[model samples]
Target: WDSVIDGNTSMEQFLNIALINAPLEKDYTILGQVLGNLQQAKNYLDLMAPMHASYNSKISKALSQMSLRMSMESYRNRDFQRRWFDAYISLSSHGEALKHIQSLLQSKSHIKGLSIDQDLRWAMIRQLNRYDYGDAQALLAQEKHLDQSDSGEKAAIAAEAIRPQSALKRQWLNTIENNDTMPFSKIRIAMFNLYPAEQKLLSAATAEQRFANLPLMDDKGPVFMRSFAAALIPTQCSAGNINAISDVLDTQTGLSQLARRALLETRQEEQRCVKIKLLLQ
Candidate 1:
């Protein structure tokens, strides 16, 4: 983040690294034949990239991204035409980013020809929905009509929960905090979608409720709360939010070790976000 803000690195590079690290952070290397295995992954992805068109099966593309990260290369994943999609939305004005996204969705994306991958399509919709776009429901409904699989159902639930509605935020908060019996599959998606860092105003409404839910998360144990705790952290690029999260870490001793570590890491992420905003401003 500092490197990017200081003009020592590109913003797109920083964003792609962050995206890769989220999934590839722990034990990311093979102990033996690391390069050999990595090369095979690279070979498979290189061979498979051209096959990824209407093929919603993202293993090929996803594997390619992972292999690129492992190789310390930047993620400009190739499409059928090898035409890239700058889908990460640059660190620019929100409206401008939305405009670009809207154009891509409208164009069905040149990268994939006349067809867009199902997962990629929903990802675009979810981004619009996060800003509470007026057509979120209709757009999500349209996509759901196209994909009736289990993955579709989960994505639809996440899209609905992600709408920037205060009531929906509050309702999901209760479900996350109180509904221990809810399957992790359901709750994890809800947790991940419910509180995007930019959605601080919506998050503010239930910020205290989330903080208070820490004990419940700890009681649920590491398996349930490890990812959930980090997901629901009410993060923003502001000192007030940072200190509020920090205070919980400082004074809250009942939290289990994993939950505490998750909180600390998330706080660090927010701090990095704060640095990016401050330097850019």
Candidate 2:
């Protein structure tokens, strides 16, 4: 909070907490800033990209898109909302929200649909696939055919990978840790989509291993570790999980400064979430 008021927090720190993408070491600082000033909301939303949580946020329309896409991502969650202002706007459940997003692409009785831009269209498709909705593979193929550009190709690759199958997810975890030759672009896609909040089974299955692999991941160097820490580190909002990671941090001497920062930041974020979970309870 002091750092935010003093106006010297790192940009990454601000963006991650704002988008609710992952935890950072000083999340509360930027969040307090966001609470104090309405304009700081976009500062919070800037980290979500390539896999669309809330990246590049500024406009209300952009937030409306994310609200529909991201709401109810976790079926276990109690509320469907996003907060740009002091109060959050209520949102619909997954199926209902998807229907509304789908309507924007085509006419719906009384509503004349507007043609959504390609990136936003892909964001919608990615959400649909994450929820394992209708004919996801076909949707990817059709969109890939429609665009046929480099960005489209990248989106297609990510869209295909985000489908929630245990076997595919296991394969991705291995690939992320071992495939050094994999392009950073694809790496970002895999990391971001591999563990949507809704896919507890996938994230839960490998949560321990994700932590265990930190040393090897850090050895890959900072560039890789930064992206991995930001996106691949699964969000486990439990005191036990936080303590487990804390134990590793307390004893693990092999982790680099960057890797250590990642763990600590994740710890702080998890702590904040734990408080919120208790309140919700």
User: How many backbone clashes does every candidate have?
Assistant: 0, 3
Q: Residues 4-105, candidate 2, lDDT per residue (tens digit)?
A: 434455433443454454212135455434434323333222212212233232333433444434333422332211221111121111455456645543
Best by TM-score: 2
Clashing pairs in 2: 1-29, 18-44, 48-55
Sequence-dependent TM-score of model 2:
0.66
Q: 1-281 in candidate 1: lDDT tens per residue?
A: 45753545543454445545534333323212232332332222222223322231233334334432333322332331111222242111145445555666778434323344677677767777776654667888898898889889888878878888888888887887788587788888988888664466677788887787788777887777877776776665567877988899988988888877887887776676555443333
Error of 2 at 121 (Å): 1.5
- In model 2, which runs have C-alpha deviations exceeding 4 angstroms? 1-93, 106-113
